[model samples]
Target: MNKITYGRQTISQDDIDEVVKALKSAAITQGEYVPAFENALKEYTGAKYAVAVSSGTAALHTVYAALGLKENDEIITCPNTFAATSNAALYLNAKPKFADINEENFLIDENKINKLITENTKIITPVHYAGLPCNMEEINRTAKSCNIKIVEDACHALGSSYNGSKIGNCIYSDGAVFSFHPVKHITTAEGGAVLTNDEEIYKKCLLFRSHGMEKVNFKHMPDSPTYHEMQFLGYNYRMTDIQAALGISQLKKIESFVKRRLEIADIYYNAFKGSSKIKMQKRYKDRLNSHHLFSVVFESNDLRDKVYYYLKENNIFTQIHYMPVNKHPYYENLGYNYKDTPLAYDFYRRELSLPVYPLLTDDEVYFVIEKINTVLKAL
Candidate 1:
């Protein structure tokens, strides 16, 4: 039997040709492809500015740094997310607070957010879990009332929309971040980007991604005529030309990729419709998701584990999207207790991610559904 993988990159020869062209170009690291990619991303997401970086974590760190989070300042985000979501704050010596997510949507609830706010809360970083857009209108209103910055951790929602606006527009937030990992809606081998309409934040991200070096045209610099200066400490978070060349190609196919994933998701949605063993993540009627991961919440943790192992035994690969960050050893030591985010902890116990991607076939979808049903029946 052929082993079916959970998620894999769908790369074409066109992607390779672009990377090859970049490899042969003179300025492979600092070339037209990088700017071209940034422009393409800017146009797609309707953001005025974007800064491409090496990885999603790097993008998160850059945006948080741009927001100027410091010690004694705090950032609030949901526990139902990858560790990188919270690690971005811990990187800045700022407190990473956990807010529980809504069980229905698996997103950080706006009402829960309002209750968690304190004078030290400097930022609200919300992850669009499973590509479902959070209630941005409410979240925005709440954040504004508290006078805190909003940074959208939109790693799973590149092509998603909320209330007719794209996810990265910064209309509801000060900044938005995206990832282009292999399993994501798009891929650049390994890359990410930060988007913002705020000029100061945009400039800060640009400088921070490239070691904070400001190349001065002798005409612009009177004090130092011959060399550039490191204005501030930064990281080498710049994405390579090879990555950008591939990204430019990948970006062109994003619409089609998203469309196909939506189709596959519909098939899975119908397959599991009215299923007694699990419940689907709720989608808001007004929002359009990219369907990055078609996740389901089993009735119980033990049933979820049985289904997971059964699927694996049948040569089908499956995965869990996350474990609540508060439960992790590192965060526990940071004084975060599980009682802090009960809803998120509850949701985390039952969630499982099945195979979902542009290349997932109908037959495979059926096999996945049939196998899951069979496993549940035995349990």
Candidate 2:
């Protein structure tokens, strides 16, 4: 009966206890909790190395830099993701070429990638949109054949899996990124990480995360204990120990969080299964969705908008996953066209994210389903 949001964090008393301990610790930033959090992530995702950062965007930017993306280099990705996915590449002065999404799954169509590959194409960023794993195995094959790198924009897929492997394992990618924003599956208040198997990439990300300065790998002065070198330009994208402490606690509950999300998604799917006016995202046998959001695609844009307003009026706060990233005013000014990815634009028009957080009670879940069905029947 109260206001229900599409996504939110569920922080336990245990999480608060950890944060309290972190606050009282001597080192809050650049401390033990940071590596502890990274280790937790590595253990969860099966990644050999994990580099925690200030935000998801920073994770992407650091990984892009690590992969040697530079001026005029191109990275192909889907248009249906948050701008951070492509904007990270832009930070390195590299161009982003978008391949359209497959209408069934709302993921990049791997078959469409070859046409976008240029001599300068450096990386293929596959976004696992709405917590559904993209076809990374196929994408990996394409990247290998083209001699390109793969950095998964897995901000929506922290607990998701593909071909029985966890999403951030980096089995099919050079590196994978995960977000720890409040709305994500896990929360560190505001944090993210880069998961990779390559030691060189891991070291580069570590350097990039802290102003490109290293105390050990000093090019100029190796003997002096105080001496450090700024190997290249980098950002101050370090996650604080307090945030890392929160993350460690949250990571422990990820399995339960993702399970609850999937249960909610299944309820929505079954409720709308026979509805002619509403459509659910296609599920694949090979991939496991983390269910960051439970999105429904309506028969028409008008109906989708009507349902959104109706839900809002009934105290349900739904959201749109995204407008096509290329359609934003900033991207438009840069000559990026939304129409180029017609499916993405169409998806944007019809999609509405329903409340699916772990804390959302079953009663609230049924209320959302009932309200949506009621709206459709009225129309």
Compared with the true structure, what per-residue lDDT tens digits does model 1 show for residues 256-297? 999988988898889888888789989778999888888899
Predictions: Cα RMSD each:
1.7, 0.8
Off by over 4 Å in 1: 217-226
In model 2, the clashing pairs are: none
Best by lDDT: 2
TM-scores for all predictions: 0.97, 0.99
Which candidate's TM-score is highest?
A: 2
> What's each prediction's clash count?
0, 0
Reference-based lDDT, residue 285, model 1: 80
All models: lDDT? 0.89, 0.93
